[model samples]
Target: MDVKLTEEEKIKVLNSDDIYGIMQKILLRESKIDQNREHFWVIGLENNHRILFIELISLGTVNKTLAEPMEVFSFALQKRAVKIILCHNHPSGELRPSEGDKDITDKLIQVGIIVNTEVLDHLIISTKSYLSFADTGLLSELKKSTKYIPQYVLEERLKKQATEIANKKKTVEIAKEFKRNGVDNETIALSTGLSIEEVEKLRVRKR
Candidate 1:
């Protein structure tokens, strides 16, 4: 007896993998945040076939900073994705959507509509479990009302933004101090994890 495989069957076989497990594995590989890291992730699907799971498209160390759609969608567009599932983890282990999260999700959904891609769901994953915005009917309501922003997301975004801004300021200060102390751009870059261009900018600013 002989066996043959069809093209569609071959494709399905090649793509056969646990989507949730794959996502968890990717998340595990990322740099573990302190008690406060804000992460934005997007999972792409093509005609009900999951293609990719991306993490930290835009991220911050604290709560106040929000992830932008452009950052999130850049990878999706690169992958030519047709549908998306957005997810973020709450370090606090709270599975509730914050105002900023809701606002961003709504904006993303609108953008998805404009770009002909569907925003299938937004999930809030904690250490142990997950909450789906669509499961709670929030997605449908957002499309209809367009006036809701959960407080949690806003707080989270603000925290992240504050942390990121503080880190950037610290980097600039370190670069300036290095320049003032007769440190070369290369040395400063190596010591501070900053680019040579950034160190050059600091040198120019110092002088």
Candidate 2:
């Protein structure tokens, strides 16, 4: 792919406010950008929080824009950015993130993890206002969401959890057997990996 940098002054981005200011400037200067249509942009950032590059990733209809992860990361990777923030305009002037916005952000976050490029935030901006996922703590919550975990990682976690559950069941069965055979609570606890209190509770339940 062809990558080129146009002449622009160096801009430092410290937070979401800085990003909003930059977006506002872009909206004013770029007459080619249709204000009636939704436009998605990927903002690449250096480790020191300076702007590396801003690439327009996609343009969609009035309310929705598509941001493919590959396309988003391509600019980020090409710029050698360590972090990225996603931005998109909503012609409807709504700040709330739609389900599609959340879904794409989640997918991009997962892809960013795989590609070693951290996704810092996703901004849904209108002419007058903006919503920041990171500022709202939605980004942290999205990281915890299990919807986009890689299949192999999910399977490995499930298998490990299953093994732990099976081992606990086996230990409980052994403890019950020891209790039935007239074994002392202390002996049952030591033999079956159960606490003495647990073995005593088992004895009571057997009555």
Best-fitting candidate, measured by lDDT?
A: 2
Candidate 2: residue 3 Cα off by (Å): 11
**Model 1 clash tally, residue pairs:** 22
Give the runs in model 1 whose Cα sits over 4 Å from its true position.
1-21, 31-35, 53-55, 146-207
Error of 1 at 108 (Å): 0.4
Q: Candidate 2's residue-wise lDDT over 1-207, tens digit each?
A: 221334452467778988887776665554545787888988888989788888888878878778888899987898899999999988888888998999999999999998999999999887778999999999998998779989997899899999999999899888888777777889888888888888777743343
lDDT of 1: 0.67
What tens-digit string does per-residue lDDT give for candidate 1 at 18-74?
A: 333444444555566633566677777677564544445556555654668787777
> Residue 136: error of model 1 in Å?
1.2
